[model samples]
Target: MSLFNGTIQALEHSLGYSSAKNRAISSNLANLDTPNYKAKDVTFKNYLAHEFSRPIQAKTTNSRHIGFQGDTQPAGYKTIINQASSYQHNGNNVDVDKEMADLAENQIYYQALVDRISGKFGSLQTALKGGR
Candidate 1:
């Protein structure tokens, strides 16, 4: 059995998802003034659904063994570009207020995951130290 019982793995995935969303939001904000730039969005529910659909029991015992491909990083998260028309005459679709809100929301989510992972490690360290 794994030491974390998959808690760490789930948390890792969550962190990656939050990070990806943050990057997308950042990118949108960064291009807020660039003409013809479209805004991008990353949805957590889609990421989780994609992650859950993968087989969890499969394992590769050797380099030659067949293993699951992809899903290695936040890149696995779906990023949807806003294709609709923009309010700005320059055709930039990014909304400053929305991107700022998303950034704040993602920061909170990312911090919570980091705290959880830190606590998980702390408990492991305590266990390793005989409850000291």
Candidate 2:
């Protein structure tokens, strides 16, 4: 038996993705004035796909029961350079407004994940404490 289940692993993967996205957004803001610096973004398609691909474990008493089908492959993030028109004449595509919005969204996502992990650990702690 594993100490941690797939859910914990999935949450860790999501946290990593969020951290990467935050870094990408911070880089874009840092290069807001750099000529020809295209703004980069971490795509969510692969992350969502990975999350949905995890198999749901179920118990069955019959041998003919249909089992859940899913991919066990690990999650990954894709960083893409934005091809949008430059907001300035310096050929830089970093939009402060968009980047700020994205940053706020990512921060919220990160905090939510943290809260989820904390809750999981809290449950475990409670169990270990004999429900006191």
Clashing pairs in 1: none
User: What TM-score would every model get versus the actual structure?
Assistant: 0.78, 0.85
Evaluated with TM-score, which candidate comes out highest? 2
Query: Candidate 1: worst 10 consecutive residues by lDDT?
Result: 68-77
lDDT of 1 by residue, 2-88 (tens): 768678988988887888898899898878899999999986666666667766655667789887565443325677888886968
- Candidate 2, lDDT over the whole model: 0.87
Whole-structure CA lDDT of model 1: 0.82
lDDT of 2 at 71: 46
> lDDT of all predictions, in order shown?
0.82, 0.87
RMSD of 2: 2.4
Candidate 2 lDDT, tens digit per residue, 31-75? 999999999999879868776767776656688998766546675
Identify the runs in model 1 with alpha carbons over 4 angstroms from their true place: 50-76
What TM-score does prediction 2 earn? 0.85
